[model samples]
Target: MFIAGDGAGIGGAKAAALAGKIAALDIACDLDRLTAGDRNAAARPLRRRLVKERAARPFIDSAYPPYAAALAPQDATIVCRCEEVTAGDIRHMAGLGCLGPNQTKAFGRAGMGPCQGRYCGLTVTHLLSEANGLSPDQTGHYRIRPPIKPVTLAEIAAMAAPEAIEKSKRSNVSTQVNG
Candidate 1:
């Protein structure tokens, strides 16, 4: 659901909380029964009373400041390693009539990469917001395209054979000519 990113930008806190809950709970729940249609089915068989477990105390270690990456660096440092798009590059797009992340992406390939903007989307949004004098929400992040099916290494290797590729190409050419 949070493909573009959560509002806080970092989802580590939620992951950390889930980890804490899993560690604390001693319930012997079967893994397979956990599904949308039958959530808590395994737990239901146990029928153990589940009182509201108080959330663990918030972890506080002032030793390091909480997430400072997004706080600063209004500099021209390269943000999108995939596209080599810098903060200045994003701002320049803004100055050149690019209002939001999508526009910048279309204009300069800022978020178009193998990583699919996972690494640089947050930074691009920040830069766009600052440049356009709008909030991050206003200069929204890129919309997620539908996910393609994942392929295994073995599947890729099988497709790499030259004879297979040539056969496929010949079929494609024949179909095109007939059509």
Candidate 2:
């Protein structure tokens, strides 16, 4: 049975677990020929255990990607709101021999993703640097912007008129300070 997951390999885990159950039922779970056209073949006992065993690590590790590979470089988008950039745009710019974080930001908007590149900046820099054959450090720092998320005009107005809004800056500051 096919399963979908967060792309962290959860599907492989589930397949392993299911294979365990199938092994218990069928008593034959050989996995030797389980690849490619072998999936349609009868389950062998050893194959079931192997499937379960093989699936465990991927399942557990599926929680997150390796540090070396943050998101699926190709699959993951490159736009950074903090930088306001997209991956494709970054690649295109990189192809033009652009380098450095500041340069990348200026050209590709690396730190402009919706999460302000808090989620994607470093990873993007790494990928871009690798593609460009530049040192990661050369990928200059991204622009540090305020209010990463979009604050509506109404919200700004409320903040401006704290007395009218009742949630004054003092209260906000006090909450933050106290917390």
Candidate 3:
């Protein structure tokens, strides 16, 4: 799996686009869709542009560092607003031997809320790492399941249509008969 763009630590839209192109070229080469020489030829310009795009990142980051307060919120500060999980709650979980965000879910439904872990995952990890005296990498992230997108009641109801219900019944009957 190739992680380009911000995931690869190349920030900004231009840099991300360039990194994506480079990653695509590399993947194509790996799949033999493009020869190594051809891939290199195609990626040279993209790499140069990506370097230029990333040049300003240091300056931008220095100008606007991450919010320090977020890294170390007050005990009562709600880290996971969706589930109303507080920093103190996360620390408490750590004290109880919760080593990571995924484990914290079993202790308290922090990242299991509607937004999943999008907004709070980082904070949760940071808090857990601090409390457990481990690096964020060691603290780990959420075990992302399906339905990544928010499903409305109407969408769910649509899935329960007569045809789908019939399919479900047939599948269940098939499973039972096979068993």
lDDT, candidate 1, 60-165, per-residue tens: 3345443556633556688788888877788889889898877877889988877778778877887788888999899888875555878899988987787888
Candidate 3, 72-106: lDDT as tens digits: 79999999999999999999999999999998789
Off by over 4 Å in 1: 1-75, 146-179
Error of 2 at 17 (Å): 43
lDDT of 1 at 103: 82
Q: Please, what is the TM-score per model?
A: 0.49, 0.37, 0.68
Best by TM-score: 3
Colliding pairs, model 1: none
Q: Is 1 or 2 the stronger prediction by lDDT? A: 1
lDDT, candidate 1, equals: 0.64
Model 1 Cα shift for residue 4 (angstroms):
14
